[model samples]
Target: MTFQDYFPIWNKLQTDQQDRIRSNLNFRTVKKGTILHNGDMDCTGLLLVKAGQLRAYILSDEGREITIYRLFDRDLCLFSASCIMRSIQFEVTIQAEKDTDLWVIPAEVYQDIMETSAPVANYTNELMASRFSEVMWLMEQVMWKSLDKRVAAFLLEEASIEGSSVLKITHEAIANHLGTHREVITRMLRYFQSEGMVRLSRGMVRLLDEDRLRQLQD
Candidate 1:
């Protein structure tokens, strides 16, 4: 993809500034299972995924890996905006779940891009705002909704994200994402499977009847 395709703000930059950013951007391909960044590591440049998938998670105090989010093709791998702005260490780990192409742009340079490119700045602001809204919504869900409802919502969201009814995930991973026990998740999955909402196969869960799942949530 051209720099403009990835960086819409490229247009806002002067010819020279745009050239500099293009020159500075470094591209790398991370293989599946590669650990891109770790918690407590220095938060550096922005990572733009050109292709493939990534999972971002935080280490709980009890040594659990609590997945915070997932990143797909063309998505930005963000950890802490505050840390990036302050140029400090990050508190999340980012791992490539599939072979991924990524563009790395230094944090300082991104700040410059935002400063010079109104379009790029606006895009960044929108990204942060959407993330904030999602977190707030998740917080409310965890506080007010039942675990069953949360699981249903999460499954639906994940299905939408993957753009398919079949979920290629393991029970342990689901438990990690939900901050719950694996057995609990397994039992819940069995219940859903029995209810004909999902079909559990070897290492995957296929959402069979979404309407039923939504009804259960209600």
Candidate 2:
């Protein structure tokens, strides 16, 4: 798809502004596990996902990673250019969760356009607000939700996303996404298996009773 196709506000900008963006945008392909942005300071620019999956996460002082949000095809990522929003300072890291294709708009170029284009500025604010809401929701989950319910919700969500009950994901990976330890995930999985809600093997968890899982989540 063309840049215009992916960008919802393409027609909102003036022709010159559109030209500036088109000229400055770059196409990049990243392998799964590639780190696209490392920290708060690197102004890697805004990422527009063309295909595949991406993850946005933060690290604890002890060096454990926890996912904040995930991106799929046609998603726009503003945190990659967090420098543009001077007030907020978060040590967020973005990585390719699957082999992906993306469009990178230089931070300076996009910022410049935002200065003169009301639509661009408004669109940016909307994106930033949406991201902040996700972060807030995550904080609520981590603080108030039980791990078992969280795990069940995550499993059901993953199953929906992959369109399968057999999840080809490791315990450690689930821990990383949920911001817990591998041992915790393993213990929980074992508990679920014993209850017949799931059947766990080397690197997969098959849902035996999704209704039970959903009930637990509820």
Candidate 3:
């Protein structure tokens, strides 16, 4: 799909505006685990995921990383163009979780359009609100949800996304996603194994009782 197809407000934009956007777009294919944008330092522009997965995360003072959200096919990530949103103070890092094909619009060009185009500006604001809501939900989960429940919920979610009960993920990776320690995740997995919820071997975790995991998460 072209930039016009990926942008939600393409029809709302004028011919000149559309032309500008098409001209400024940068298309790239990145390998898995590639860092597209590193925190607040790079205004990598608005990212439109044509295919594959991307993760938006933040790093703590102690160097731990926690994912804010994941972007999949057809998702528009406004936070990548963070330079345009002066009010957003925190830094966010964008990384490809799988081989990805994406389009990036230069921050200045998008900001310029947002300034002159009501449809673009409104869309941008609404998108930012949605992203913030996701972040707020994550914060609530961290604060109120127990680690066991969180772990179970994360497992269920991963299973759903991957479409398999057998997950090829390591305890360290799971810990990074949950903002916890590897030892903690290992212990939790061991407990789950004992309860017949899962069977773990090396970096693989196979679900034995997904219904129990769902109930536990609730």
The per-prediction CA RMSD against the true structure, in angstroms, equals 2.7, 0.8, 0.8
- Sort all candidates by lDDT, best to worst: 2, 3, 1
lDDT of 1 by residue, 48-79 (tens): 87888888777767877766677877777556
In model 3, pairs of residues that clash are none
Off by over 4 Å in 1: 80-82, 87-90, 115-122
lDDT of 2 by residue, 25-129 (tens): 899999999999989878899999999899999999987888999999989999999898898777889999899999999999999999998999999999889
CA shift of 134, model 1, Å: 1.9
Q: How far off is residue 196 in model 3, in Å? A: 0.6
Q: Estimate each model's TM-score.
A: 0.84, 0.98, 0.98
Model 2 segments more than 4 A misplaced: none
Residue range 1-218, candidate 3, lDDT tens digits: 67678777899999998899888789999999999998777999999999999999998999888989999998999888888888889899999999999999899999999999999989988988999999999999999999999999999999999999999999999998989899999999999999999999988999999999999999
lDDT of 2: 0.93
On the 0 to 100 scale, the lDDT of residue 91 in model 2 is 84
- Candidate 1: give the clashing pairs: none
- Runs in model 3 with CA error above 4 Å? none
The candidate 3 region of ten consecutive residues with least summed lDDT is 1-10
Of 1 and 3, the candidate ahead on lDDT is 3
